[model samples]
Target: MKIDFEKIAEEHIEGFKGGEGRLDTRNYVDDRARIMYSTLRPGPKSGKHPHAGSFEVMYVVSGELTVHYDGSEEIIKMGQVHYCPNGHQHWFENKTDHDVIYFAVVPTLG
Candidate 1:
């Protein structure tokens, strides 16, 4: 079906996944997946962690995000997508002066 993010309330998170700083997120979660709209201020990071039972895919809406995963780093800009496979470690950082806006989805596994 359709999910309207505007109807979702924002959740302000600090040190998400054990990282530094805060992020604004609106999320919808079900038994199978978690879909979220997220924004990170400059100089903030999503803590590095491993996805043990799911794969996460993030789509950049605007600005830039530096993604670290599987011993590598990638810069994802607007219109780009990054995916971290299940059982992999990953994190994201916003290093620019602008806010990093993105949509991320994680699908749960059995």
Candidate 2:
């Protein structure tokens, strides 16, 4: 199937943080995979959380973000990607001075 993405900016925007309040999401379920598009604002964070039943893979589409996982943290900037395995704790934040866009993939019902 083909998916048009022109209206994603207005349809799916949740889990916003400080600086600016916006969360854009485009969720698609394919077989058992759930694909999503998320946008974050500067000085905002996804906060610390854990993936209960899914492994989340994220691709940074624009700007920069700091990712914390397991017991360490790293900056996943623009053009970079990161993966958080299932049952692991992770979090992401836009500590930079610019906006950031990212795409995430997870399992259905996860």
Candidate 3:
């Protein structure tokens, strides 16, 4: 199946997932998973949290982000991907001058 993100309305969220600043995203959610195209602005971050019953995969489309995974810091650049397995903790931060655009999918565990 094909998903057209352009057809989805974008939402600007403040303190997304309890993080600072805002996140602009277009999301498609169902009982099984959530797929999204998001842009993380500079100086903002995704709140640190654990994936209790789901796993997340994020592919960077442009720019970069600093991912705090578990207890370490990883820099995910354009064309790179970051995966957070179930039961792991992670968060994303955009500390650069440009926006960090990415595609993410979170699949729920049965």
RMSD in angstroms, candidate 2? 3.3
lDDT of 1 at 37: 98
After TM-score superposition, what is the CA distance of residue 43 in candidate 2 from its true location, in Å? 1.1
Residue-level error in angstroms, candidate 2, position 9: 6.1
* Cα lDDT for residue 65, candidate 1: 96
Give the poorly placed runs of model 3, Cα more than 4 Å off: none
- Clash number for every model? 0, 5, 0
After superposition, candidate 1 runs with Cα above 4 Å error: none
Cα lDDT, all candidates:
0.94, 0.75, 0.95
| Candidate 2 Cα misplacement greater than 4 A, ranges | 9-21, 29-31
Candidate 3 local distance difference test against the native: 0.95
Q: How do all models score by TM-score?
A: 0.97, 0.77, 0.97
Q: For model 1, how does the per-residue alpha-carbon lDDT over 86-110 read when each residue is reduced to its tens digit? A: 8899999998999999999998899
For candidate 2, give the lDDT.
Answer: 0.75
lDDT of 3 by residue, 36-74 (tens): 999998899989999999999999999989999999999
True lDDT of residue 39, candidate 2 = 72
